[model samples]
Target: EPEVTQTPSHQVTQMGQEVILRCVPISNHLYFYWYRQILGQKVEFLVSFYNNEISEKSEIFDDQFSVERPDGSNFTLKIRSTKLEDSAMYFCASGDTSGTSTDTQYFGPGTRLTVL
Candidate 1:
């Protein structure tokens, strides 16, 4: 089975800098999600996108964050202003095109963002 792919496995940026994390989800998946794990903390959902629009977003997804599928094959997350607290392992995931809420989501290896 095809898996998700994330670029620049690790990124180090100054505080307040902007960063864009890229991912290529499964070719046929319909639901896409962006999640983050702050070191030892539990994974938290940032946002979900489907059909070229945002389906839902968590409070953590403030004005500083945005999600977009610029193309049919690429889904991306942009952090306009990175803070120390924004340092985390960001994951890109996609649900199988099963057309159900319970569809399993496959996660990418993740992009580690470090803010100094």
Candidate 2:
């Protein structure tokens, strides 16, 4: 069961410009995540990478937000400028779940950011 894949599933920027949302996690999963769900609320957490750097991030991942893997498969999310509450549905996740709870966190099939 291999999942986690996202692309231009839906994106309609305009509020400030800049937008780059893409994902392809689940190939062995080494811990990776970026979530958003500002439509009806819930699901927040903004960033978390591994091995390459940035092991954790939150507070909406300020500084305009940015995450990258750019290789070994692909994983990116950059919104340098975009407002209108940043409209959301973005989600990309992978997991090792070493902390327990069984281990599973594969999500992807989201990229509905419409800020205008």
Candidate 3:
């Protein structure tokens, strides 16, 4: 079965630097989302994209963040300026939200971003 894949399972960066987390979402899926968990916190939604435009976004998606579908299969999240509080496990998910009750999101293993 197709699954979401993320690169550099773990990353450590200093504050003020930039980082780009990569993800390969499941093929044939339409709805893509980004979520993060800060250690013991709950999974917070960042953004959701479809048809090459943002469908919904949370307050967590601030000016420092951006997302792109650079190709047919690759999706990426870029943080222009990192902060210590930005440390978290970033997860990429994809699902088919075409009114199908069986459509559930499949998440990647996650990319742990550590900012110091």
Off by over 4 Å in 2: 5-32, 35-46, 49-55, 58-60, 63-82, 85-89, 97-107
Which candidate number would show the highest lDDT if scored against the true structure? 1
How well does candidate 2 match the true structure in TM-score terms?
Answer: 0.31
Between candidates 2 and 3, the one scoring higher on TM-score is 3
lDDT per prediction? 0.95, 0.87, 0.92
True lDDT of residue 5, candidate 3: 99
Provide the global lDDT of candidate 3 against the true structure.
0.92
RMSD of each: 0.8, 12.2, 1.6
Compare candidates 1 and 3 on TM-score and give the better one.
1
**Local error of candidate 3 at residue 29 (angstroms):** 0.6
**Which pairs of residues clash in candidate 2, taking residues 3 or more apart in a chain or in different chains?**
none
Tens digits of per-residue lDDT, candidate 3, 8-104, equal 8999999999999999998888888899999998999999888888888999899999999999998999999999999999999998758255768
Best by TM-score: 1
Residue-pair clashes per prediction, in order, are 0, 0, 0
Better of 2 and 3 by lDDT: 3
Per-candidate TM equals: 0.97, 0.31, 0.94
